[model samples]
Target: MTDEDRYELLGEIGRGAGGVIYRARDRDLGRDVAFKLLRREGSTLDARVRFVAEAQIPAQLEHPNIIPIHDVGRTRDGSLFYVMKLVQGQTLKEHLNGRTSRSELLFAMLQVARGIAFAHHRGVIHRDLKPSNVMIGLFGEVLILDWGLARPTRGLSTARDEHGGTMTLDGDVLGSLGYMAPEQARGEVHRQGPPTDVHAFGGVLYELLTGRPPRHSRTLGELIPRLNELPEPAPGPLGALASRCLAPEPGARPQSGEELLALLERVT
Candidate 1:
């Protein structure tokens, strides 16, 4: 049986620029899973490589806060697909819709920091970090999702495909606008590192404390100049930390997710 035959697609969960994710059932195991299939049409070669790396990278990480990949294969139609645990919960963005408990929000953000710390320990960096990418399960479990932009931090600064071609070219900006670190917004791919995610962690925390993101700019150009102009967060330690994370210089922020986790632990 082929990869597609082994799983039954129940319905589509969502769609993104790279591909669509479906709710599927594993025929052999009789278990429900999330099947992400790459877009066959209009997908560039770089996107394809990143899609495959997304699956491969997370599979190597066995952290409780990170989504786990169950299987990966190509469909009979030649489309790349991967199966992962089907988490039942709303994203942190959605979860914060009607919630206002500071402690609860801090707990969720702490879990996200733990996950990112583990990935950094494994020599990988999550270039994209935002509340939307964080899922809070029905049982209060926090899991980080969508690692399609992750890259190794060992020897190279920028990610490269098997053929050694740069996957994220210089000046090829990626990541969400408000959550992006200043270096990321400028498309300084080489400057991206653990500090990059720390900046985003601050943005997430700022949004949790305030109703909006740290930066209110609607476009990259608008955001660049106003990167340092952050709205005041909740009046406390958490708020203070958020401001530190949003510092324009990467050195001014926590050096890594590990450092961020440590700092967050001090917040009561």
Candidate 2:
């Protein structure tokens, strides 16, 4: 059988800044799958390390909402590739392109919070938790994808706080600009724990309600002050919870992802 015929490569599914994803099928297993192929230009040592780390992260996690990594290996040309369950759906970012109802928003965020809580309990922090990273399937499944920037800080840390996890080595900002925590924007080398993930969740909730980012500013210098001193949106339970979750100080935010989920349930 031809390589393509041996294992069917159906078509391209998605593309990201780091790699391209494809829909495939396992000929032996008789099941559909997805493959993530890293860009050739970014297949350097650091990139390969990051890719392997991501592949292993999900293997360590056994949660319904978190996407599980199925396999990983290097291509003959030295390119890196990984496989995962093929989830057929658009991202939360895509779902929010137009008007979104409150119940719909709450339903989506609930799945995200549950998944993140599972990761947090396992001592894994998803440094990148944005709408684009959340996939909502047609079969009523929400899968949290991408862990290239996850930080595992259970009992390991250093003065610089590099806990040997799949972290960004270049000190490049981890989270997306609008969803990043205040301390993260400062380039602080602190060990990202559960609280960091909570902050990003809050940002997601804010955008879900208002159809805009929680902290909006042109530059980092401008964003810090806005995040610190910005007034609460309005008189609503979800709005109040959003403010608390997006608190400038991580200490002022929810202690864990589970706590945030509880609060969302109460507010919703």
**Whose lDDT is greatest here?**
1
Cα lDDT of model 1 overall?
Answer: 0.85
Candidate 2's displacement at residue 16, Å, is 2.4
Give me the runs in candidate 2 sitting further than 4 Å from their true place: 1-6, 39-42, 155-168, 217-227, 231-234
Give me candidate 2's TM-score against the actual structure: 0.87
The residue-by-residue lDDT of candidate 2 on 75-186, one tens digit each, is 6566778889888888899888856576876798898999998888888888889999998898778999998777666632322243344445453365687888877777
The CA-based lDDT of model 2 is what?
0.77
What local lDDT score does residue 133 receive in model 1, on the 0 to 100 scale?
A: 95
Question: For candidate 1, which ten residues in a row score worst on lDDT?
Answer: 154-163
TM-score of each: 0.94, 0.87
- Indicate the TM-score of model 1: 0.94
**Clash pairs detected, candidate 1:** none
Task: Identify the runs in model 1 with alpha carbons over 4 angstroms from their true place.
Answer: 155-160, 166-172
